[model samples]
Target: MSAYTTRQDLPGSLPAAASSALRLGALASDERFEVTVRVRPRAAPPDLAASAATLALKPAQQQQLSREEYAAAFGADPADLAKVADFARHFGLVVLDSSSARRSVFLSGTADQFAAAFGTQIEQVEHAGGVGRAVAAPLSVPSEVGDIVEGVFGLSDAPVARPHLQQLPEAQAAAGASFTPPQLAKLYNFPTGVDGSGQCIAIIELGGGFRTTDISNYFKGLHLPVPKVKSISVDGGKNHPTTANSADGEVMLDIEVAAGVAPKALICVYFAPNTDKGFLDAITAALHDKVNQPSVISISWGAAEKFWTPQALSSYDAAFQSAATLGVTVCCAAGDAGSGDENPDQGQPDGLAHVDFPAASPHVLACGGTRLKANGSSIASETVWNDDPLRSASGGGVSDFFDLPAYQNGAGVPASANPGGRVGRGVPDVAGDADPNTGYQVLVDGRRLVFGGTSAVAPLWAGLVALMNQKLGHHVGFLNPLLYGAAVGSGATHDITVGDIGAYQAGAGWDACTGWGSPNGAKLLQVLGS
Candidate 1:
């Protein structure tokens, strides 16, 4: 891969077209420049076909594209230009000057002209979000599926499970488990001598600002310490006023999970509004986060590939690399969407990045989700969490972009999943509680909801990093090398033993879904302590 195109960074949530370029005019000259642009989705009306729980589109607005031709538009990332170059070269599509985070960039030439030349519709290239969301449809819940699974597993069992992770698990209440810091800390115990008192843990959230009152209430309710949480806003996005959004819900879960697992650590949240610009800007700010000097940053947001560009990846590559030099460990969600982002169309490399972007970046750690069943003192059955195509799934799969990093080779993970087979870089390096049906309990704007997704895993891992820093005498910058080759018997990590997240089934060893399984907090501390 050439330097201009060899970027292996995690693709971000920003639309993919935002980074493209082109050879403008009838005469291809250096004067013909490229500009970043976006292909926004037209509003789709509410229908039974909706897969997303968040706002749905208005309807089949395909005709909306014919009039999309524009005489002017501007201000996109240089990446948008690359998209133009890449797409045009691949399909002879023209490049347009107009750009945006939502609207797809036009190729400037008339749609009919492009159709005449390429034999393909040039006006609207489908944004894969809807298509990707459809892949999990196979996992949809059978109205009685949760009951059947729970019944067979026996809900009366100690520390049982509910259909969702974030919802109030009757098992948690029945087992007398409370979401207190110390009690939960055991789940992330640093090796015997570890402590995180001096380390910092930074959290990246899109919305759902935590209030001082909520902190007091949460801690007082749990009889735990009030974590030191500092709020930082990026791209000038302000603290959200509180609302319901998967983006914000995921953010809240990240903070609470990290805090619960590593209470004594300093927690700083970098907030960005729920937009691609704010999301990208927030991460850039986190990479250079001052005052906090956080050795670990946790992220839990993601979108499909094709939605991002190499330039975006290159920009983030710098940050991830910087964190590494600074000894910071970057953790991200592997997306809640599953494998190949499922496309019914055909097997074309998803024009998009896979799973989670930043997480897919070779510079960071990607975390996947799992559904777990625990008894009084032991984790009974654990499985890779996929939203029963019927329910949805935790994201996991190989990247069409990022190259395989050195840390990816040893883990029994086959080299084939790396289709486009040229690149390397595996994902969900480490994971923990992310089964929304069996997820953690929480309070957001005083509203209680059950939640789980790869979102919960990122921060949970960050909290573990804080404790590792406490024990190792410094931050455990990138944990992959350490976790990947460790002996299977090393009690430090638990190998997930059941269930399946999409195509990957949970087994005795590492699988694509749950990377070393969930942590054996107590033993992990013992091993890391050594």
Candidate 2:
């Protein structure tokens, strides 16, 4: 299960940045609450050193695992999971669901049962945009269960993640010509044949909805086949669209981008709440889903790493690790707020360098933003996306949380410039066009809208990865090792050398702003496919 919490050093209260002391109201004790118990991974991936060694070898020499095989090798111990479930039942919590592969136990009970079981109080707290219920105090479990439970999430109903997609205003949209995703794909030299048939792409969203008419109309306009699009709800979240929420734009952008590039691929959209619990559960569910079995998953929601709880961070990282063990490639947006990644609610920029989570997680491919200038079907000039200081910019920086992974050890990496004197993981392992000035056009809610952000890059990369899988006739899981290895210098990517993202600037090879750079799709397929 999870680490047994015994030491006093374990965090007692939520991070000041994550929880609020101000109570707006209180939740009724009779209300039902759904909480998740995240468990520890069965074991660390066989040996990071050995794994890298294998990656260095030819594709034929690489060891690959099917989902079932991977679960057998890396999933949580069943007995440990049972122990957690037993504890939940002891506290009068109903066992709603459990997944051994994801090492998670889902429980539901009245607010009174939850409060009594976890030794924490729940209260309605004031939050940005609206008021929500959340855990108001430190959570502590029995010594036995506390040791095994990695994180007790879903107790709080706080909204944490922000959708990375930003729609262009009417003025901005009318200012320039917007390119459809396929048009952009062609300019980037994405292969013409191999339309991602027989491949599945999973798009994760915190909130948003897309209409079938919008998607069908979009593909019809491009004179391409309309790929299958399906929605799966998680943690009571729905594909609900509202005029007040711009999240629907994010949902549509992700789907259209991936589907446009890989027109024949099946697109599965996972809609979850914007809270940490919902985000974590969605990822875990997507990672462990055996039916849809997406070859690649794209995420366009995230918050600054510092805003997440320790358990939240570890649990999410563990999920990414599991994706690596399985033959699944995950792509996440680096954020749109440059290096500062400041909280908008904080009044002004903190002037501190911060990185977005899920993107910063070592196991996933973090996609940054770029401004692309293309003439007809050829790329003109691409630079790091940096708009205005007060507005959006490509997010990239040394992480305040994760350490540098072994794959990131070589050239194009900088040493720690922070006070901690620790070399943390650098972001934007790969990048794509995300500037609204050169954004992707999509049909959302029956309206044609242009949007941009690192959000577009995640699904764009995921679609490219799906096409690569189709062309190679196999899944290329966990791209970092390959992207950083022998194929790096083999013309697989277009290195961006201009522009900056707040505190960090772009340069040759790798930089915090745009990493190795944008894709040269066909060449990448050839190099990585080999």
Candidate 3:
């Protein structure tokens, strides 16, 4: 007894790699789990295009909406939520939770129940991340609710992304030129007299966790007060710190680097599973959390555009759009694997250049990497971070998914170096020192290790944004449009004019490798403040 006699395909619901995965067996019928259903927004979002233009030209004139205001205006429709909940009841699935602000409904049921509800076969599949569950075919929903449903996630729990982090070997780490976060802040000339006292930085972590003892000891070593840090569990993910070789490195690095720069800024970490559903849920939760009300968010995890589903990409981008309207800035790591975001040891498996997602999303502040040499407190040399083109390097290139945005018009962004040579949005909107040979010294699992990658760069930029927000007396939401315009010629950045990253090179003003170069904090603050 279903609500509708017919069914329709859920757009962008199938993972690109699903068909290629090694078939293990049918999923046990009695196995139980949860899935998230994304409902369409109540109405079309506000004119973000016009808002972006204004934010670039006259940030002071831009109007920001609070969390409550946004929900009331753009959240899901009550009637639509009721229809979805009724549909779930018809299929014997329990409605675990629902949120208008996030436009999501959490449903729990057995594998057989989900298979019946979505009109798909659940099966065990072997992917790079090991055995997991996935739908053997495209997901479908009751025709009555098809148009109202944006996506159905957690049907497939394959690993979605890897942490964009690189740690040097103990021997090399001990011998390399590494600097503490404070030293880098000084070199970059961050604005003085502001410690981000009133701002909250939201950090998204897919795996791993941080220890209180580690946070205390690390800050004590730096001679700085331990910033208040809190954790929010998403989809059952929590702060479970294991060993140094695990994702704890990424978790600790993000916290230490961001806190080290903005000592008094409150840090809220949202831990989620490394699945598409978990990732998206974590982002929405952070963006809509009224308690924390983060002014900026830092994401150090992502994969190439090719690995993601069309629905997941659009959904995540939509969440970021909501972030812009709420006057929140999101900083994302570009990638550590150069233009080819896959296994570097394999040498471009498909031979096509790729850019990491979330970073490639035009709405985010895409942070790239650099190698630096300092003389005293001033930088002697800075270049595109490329230690091995076939391995570690700053990921940069034209995006294959997103179109070229208006803000990059005068920046001379080049087309993708791949065969088709299609023009698209360029990446690494900003950069920072990320070479393991010239990395940041961080404490992970009680071990002091040197880490580098675009991962460090995300939190580094997030920390700077906190300081900027504190100084400007407002949130510097959606900073890309401004960065490409006024901040370009105003000495707000260091403009790296040397080196390359395999498929692309760096020179003059904006290039794929370093995107207008690293920060000159004080100058950037002045430009934004004006």
- Which numbered prediction scores highest in TM-score against the true structure? 3
- Model 1 C-alpha lDDT per residue in residues 1-530, reported as the tens digit of each score: 12222212112322343322221223211112121223212222121111221112111211111111211221233454354345443434455433232222434333333332222222121222211010100111122111111000000001100111234444444443333333335544434444467878887776566656666676667666777888887645556646634344655666677876666788888876544445555664665555666778987765554445454555455446545544577888776656544332223433332555777776677887777655544555667776553235666656656655555555565443433444355666667766656666665656555566677778877887787777667455645555654424686677766666554555666666777777766676555445
* Alpha carbon deviation, residue 279, candidate 1 (Å): 3.0
Please give, for residues 1-530, the per-residue lDDT of candidate 2 as tens digits. Answer: 43434432225337536454368666788888788888765765653322457448543345667778877877777877888888788778999988878788899998888887787788877776477677777887777755567787888777778888767886889877678888888887887678999999999888868888888898999998988998899998788866424788888889899999998999998888888788988988888788999989999999788778877877788788778767688999999988877646444655667788889998889999999998777888999998863358898888777877888877456754456655688898999999998898888777777899999999999999899889888888878888888677888889999999877889989899999999888888777756
Q: Between the candidate structures 1 and 2, which one is better when assessed by lDDT? A: 2
The per-candidate count of clashes, in order, stands at 76, 4, 0
* C-alpha RMSD values across all candidates: 17.3, 2.7, 1.6
Q: lDDT of each model, Cα atoms only? A: 0.52, 0.81, 0.90
**Which runs of model 1 end up more than 4 angstroms from their true locations?**
1-184, 187-195, 244-247, 274-277, 342-353, 415-423, 486-489
Ranking by lDDT: 3, 2, 1
User: Which run of 10 residues does model 1 get worst, by summed lDDT?
Assistant: 151-160
